[model samples]
Target: MMKAKQRIIILLLAGLLVLTAASCSSQKAADPATETLKLGVLSLEDILPMVVANEKGYFAEEGLTVELIPFQSTVESQSAIQSGDIDGMMNDMVVAALLKESGTDLKVTSVTLEATDERRRFAIVVSPDSDIKTVADLKGRELGISFNSIIEYTTDEMLVAAGVSPEEVNKTAIPKIPVRLEMLINNNIEAANLPDPLITFAEFNGCKTIIDDRGRSIS
Candidate 1:
């Protein structure tokens, strides 16, 4: 079995390969008449650059027409890409891998964000009143996550890093981040992994953080 860090690196490299190949293929097949490219985005701070570029008419300045398509979650964005509704989206390396494995012609051309000790972006959290204070306490408990996506991948890795086997925890698919956050706040699940903005929001509202991707990088 691959070590946790190795697995993360391999997955990211695979994403880069898929992304580079897709970009080349698309460029070769591009039509000058249709200059518009539709890209999917979520309501996360990580997508702020694209938003600013669009709002500031950067694409227009380059004689390019770019459409910023908004989706409620990564799962929705992936569906849009798979169905040809959108050409691509800003997503995690893990999501890129999952898309490719499911036969979606996609690529990850950039690393917009990286988790670090000084800039933690994702975390495993619990209700403020829950007694699950440590990673080991998560054993045999159900973790709310969007299954098969980046959230699940990070949660597993963080658990392993904390000396807890991933097999010891159960993952429940709660597709929407808002719904997952709500459930977590209501104590409907023992724990949940969330990304920033929501992670910050949850902490402010009294959720206790168990562990985070501090000092870690997905790529």
Candidate 2:
């Protein structure tokens, strides 16, 4: 019940974000009366607001029907969007830009999550058995991240802040979040950047966080 309430509050904030972004990008939001929107999303915790809102009839109150579609990976979700299977997506800025670059008509609708001074959504963690103890130790090391995505972007930003040059930053692309988490837990990957719940789960499983998006503007 507490979690549900928390998600409801987040839903309010997300509602504001969507309205503000929609107004900036266009004249106004689509008429909610008798409108239906099919939205695609990965199975990430950030979907809580959407879930809560839908369950609570927030959209219905606005006369909109939102259908949430689940995709296992970002690539799958992007493909679905390209093929017109879904009208919109809950994705990071990096992916939104990628979609625009690939000629898909896209817009920054809203931010599901962002790093704040008190909290961050992403982190770089090392296996319990791995020798990489510090951020500096990650230079030229195998760091798993989804290439050209927000995962890699966050990793790079944090690495450079720790004095690791772009050339020295070695990153391995493991796009699937579950795969990255599994590999890191199994010691198949020395380190990987993961979002909140997964990052906390990995830490519970003995992974050590060396750096995160905390205090940084990037998310």
Candidate 3:
């Protein structure tokens, strides 16, 4: 019985050794330098260059088969990276900064957009007949903005520029641009801040732009 037990122990040790060797071999075979790199990306139209680079075989030329995974939001993409479901992602500075702040070992290898572009402006609009004429008038009024978005940042900047502190305004998070536009039109909210497509659409449908980067900033 002792001999049989010794033999079983030897077999288990041998199996562990074999498994270790197989794992080493598998890792060597799964070299990122030669294997596909999975990239998680947010569903933004600005990622056209990355899409083009992959479709045009630019990554393949560098011995990389980039598997592009599109997520609906940056938060979703960041979660993918944190969970090791993806190798890397194309994210904004603020998003990456937030990840770093939360103790995630994420790094930014490139800058996708200008650090400060004059064209990157977020528009603040009010209903044509709304009493609010300027950012100053937004005090105590409900302003709709998309949370964790560029529009939110620009809106804050606009408010600060107009001497209206965040404490003076009641900013609400409404994620959908269409919903924000509809609210602005139906006079449900005092004003809404969003990107050009919605801003243009709203202005076209009777919402007036109260604060826009006429010539100062990029959108």
TM-score of 1: 0.80
Which ten contiguous residues of candidate 3 have the minimum total lDDT?
A: 15-24
Q: Against the hidden true structure, what lDDT does model 2 obtain?
A: 0.78
- Model 2: per-residue Cα lDDT at residue 59: 67
TM-scores for all predictions: 0.80, 0.82, 0.63
Q: What Cα-based lDDT does every candidate model obtain?
A: 0.75, 0.78, 0.65
Total clashing pairs in model 1: 3
| Model 3 lDDT per residue over 12-120, tens place | 2332111011122334456556676777765444455566666766666556777888765556776777777777776555666666777767555554433234453
- Model 2, residue 192: what's the lDDT? 92
Q: What is the lDDT of residue 210 in candidate 2?
A: 91
Best by TM-score: 2
35-116 per-residue lDDT for model 2 (tens digits)? 5687887667788778778898776766789898877567777777787777777777787777778777766655676778
Query: Which of candidates 2 and 3 is the stronger one according to lDDT?
Result: 2
In angstroms, the error of model 3 at 25 is 20
Q: Where is model 2 more than 4 Å wrong at Cα?
A: 1-36
Q: After superposition, how far is residue 163 of candidate 1 from its true place, in Å?
A: 1.7
> Model 2: what TM-score?
0.82
List, residue by residue over 1-219, the lDDT tens digit for candidate 1.
236444444443342212233644556666534756887776667766565556766556556687888776788877777777777676777778877887776656766666766887789999767889899999988889887777888888899899999989988889888889998888778789998888888889789898998887752
